[model samples]
Target: MEEEPCSLVYRLEQKYLNDDDAYMDQDIVLTNFTGSSPCKMASKRALELVVLNNANISHLGDVSQVSGLMQHVAEADLAWNSIRWECVKSVLKHLPQLRTLNLSYNPLDGEIAVDLPSAPLLHTLILNGTNLSLTSLSSILKNTPCLQELHLSDNKLDFSDDDESVMNESVKTIHMNRCRIEDWAQVVRLMRRFPNRKTVFLCENPIKSIVHQTPVEDLSTLQSLNLGKVELIFQEFSQKKLIQIYNIIDFLDRSFNDTTLEAQVNH
Candidate 1:
């Protein structure tokens, strides 16, 4: 975890990181590129995957001038960097063939909307710890409609007073782990918005009081649901409310188990 002297983004491994060249040229997978120094990368040809994990990248200062460094990149991991929200758009703009992108641990406080629809091939996006809001996130996802999995874990998303918004069609799995959501009504709202959604990770949310009537059909499409560590009662609930809670728990257990079995068979 020492400060690395200025180096090219491509030589981040072996020469640095863990001093292991295992990720040098393994079918476009890069790894162990941690440092507090700026990154400058240049190659004769375009690479497929580029990982700049924990590189302390701020505003993309190092490789701002590098032209076409990752034109053909399919997967790019820029996690654990303090990258500006504006710079994310520039990074994606540079890589047309990008399919997977990880921008976690970047505090993107402002409403920075990246034109993700441009990359039709992009499917999986990870924005954990980005502090993305419900409204801003909806705008972002509208462009990335083809995404299959979207990760927004630890983003501090407050949905207690949020209204329902439109969502992507292709997104089947959504991770909202530790988002601090308190109201169960908001959860129902999300289910309504994303009817095609198969999995929802709501672990560690401040969810309680499911007394309000929730239709069974509202969450019928859900295949996997993670409500672990979520409280279900606050005050003395009516018997009707307890019945609704039982119904949800039963549905989640049965539906998720069935989906798991199906996945296992397919794999």
Candidate 2:
């Protein structure tokens, strides 16, 4: 069992944070706060990290019903619940200091293009398993300009059209594993647009086969690219009876480079 946070020992508000300082008033957890609104308690205590996840809450208005814990909150885990985009925007109104939000595992497929709250402090957003598209995604990016890390894995993402992802330079890491994207041009567009993208996860996407064919001319900023599962990709081709294995050697030879490539050079 987890040690019940060693009781809040009232220490004089001092400059140096030592072992004597109690961790009690630091976090307010109500994962099982089933029939009660915990934000009132959070507001009363001015908690820093509020975890209301798995609380069977339909809308974030439950928190708005009771006031208080808005100014001090830095992290919120509202994942694994029935939350919509509007509810999240309402959450931003109270949690301006919020940096990380976990909205994963929720079926928020209907919400689209809802205006984001003005929270410059917000940096990370976890939207895993949410059926997202270009239109809904653009709406979110339009509202939040300072997002640095975005997670949109396990969704149906197809950027075959000429739609450009409205991602800011602040965003450096993108996780899109198993998104089913088949367009290499869309992937190239993302790489060209984001000047600071250090890590990109495109594994298990349909666009893997085209990587060898597509000239990655604009991926100078990319440091880590997870395009593994070569066996799976080849097996997928075999299962579909699309191409013969004899072309595999040709594919490898064309993608290999004898000289170190410049960031701007064509592959």
Candidate 3:
């Protein structure tokens, strides 16, 4: 006979609320949890990170469960769950101090329209592999007034020619890796949309050749840009005009090397 599945409340208590060793760690991670029961962990104000990834959770059945436990959570990872856009709004309502939220791989494609609650403190939001649309992206920008970093990688984003420009002043970094962006002009439009963007990753897109042919003026003011698999044609541009782009490429190279070195050192 198979052993019984642990309740979410019991698992949380065993790992965080009751464990003496976990007292120093202010994280509550319950991945692959199938229990439908509400997490009744007594309010733990000290907790900062709450990860419920791949839990098959559609919604927080009890709002009190969220309010009492995740009120002060700074980062929440609810990735690979069955959560909708409305549920995200509810989570934001309770998690007032949430600085980073990972809602990647959630089934949000069915949401025709949504109005997210104001998340003034939210800075980073990951929506990778969520099958998002421009309409949903617009709603996200409207609510996350102070958002600085956005991850929309692995999604099929089809921006039409007639779409009006969407601007958000606070957004400084964006990750659009593997987004299948085919047009160089579309890339320029994206940059314009996020006027204050300092860092942008458009890796694995089909606009590599177009990037080299585009005017340098179209790509100025960017501090860091990752064009993965997009090689630069150094012979086509003058050294003075290409210096900024060269610096960005050098930065990406150095960042990769540093990360590799750190991993090697740890190993």
TM per prediction: 0.71, 0.67, 0.70
After superposing candidate 3, which stretches have Cα over 4 Å from the reference? 1-26, 29-44, 208-220, 231-267
For residues 1-267, could you state the per-residue lDDT of candidate 3 as single tens digits?
Answer: 844433333333444555355442435533333443223233434356776666665655554443556567788888887788767877787788899999999898764355678899999999999987877777777888899999999998877745657657789889998887776667777777786777888876655223344455444546666665543333444666356555544543454432211000010
Candidate number of the best TM-score = 1
Q: Per-residue CA lDDT of candidate 2, range 179-233, in tens?
A: 7777655666766556677777776676534433445445555656665443455
Tell me the tens digit of each residue's lDDT in model 1 across 1-267: 866432334333322233234544443432333343212122334456777777666654444434455566788888877676566766666677888989898767677655533557779999999887677677767767578899988887766545665577788888887887777777778767777888888877766555446766777777777766544332345667656766756655674445431110010
Worst lDDT run of 10 residues, candidate 1, spans 258-267
Ranking by TM-score: 1, 3, 2
Residue pairs with backbone overlap in model 3: none
Which is superior by TM-score, 2 or 3? 3
lDDT of each: 0.65, 0.58, 0.66
Q: Write out the backbone clash pairs for model 1.
A: none
User: What are the C-alpha RMSDs, in order, of all predicted structures?
Assistant: 7.4, 10.3, 8.8
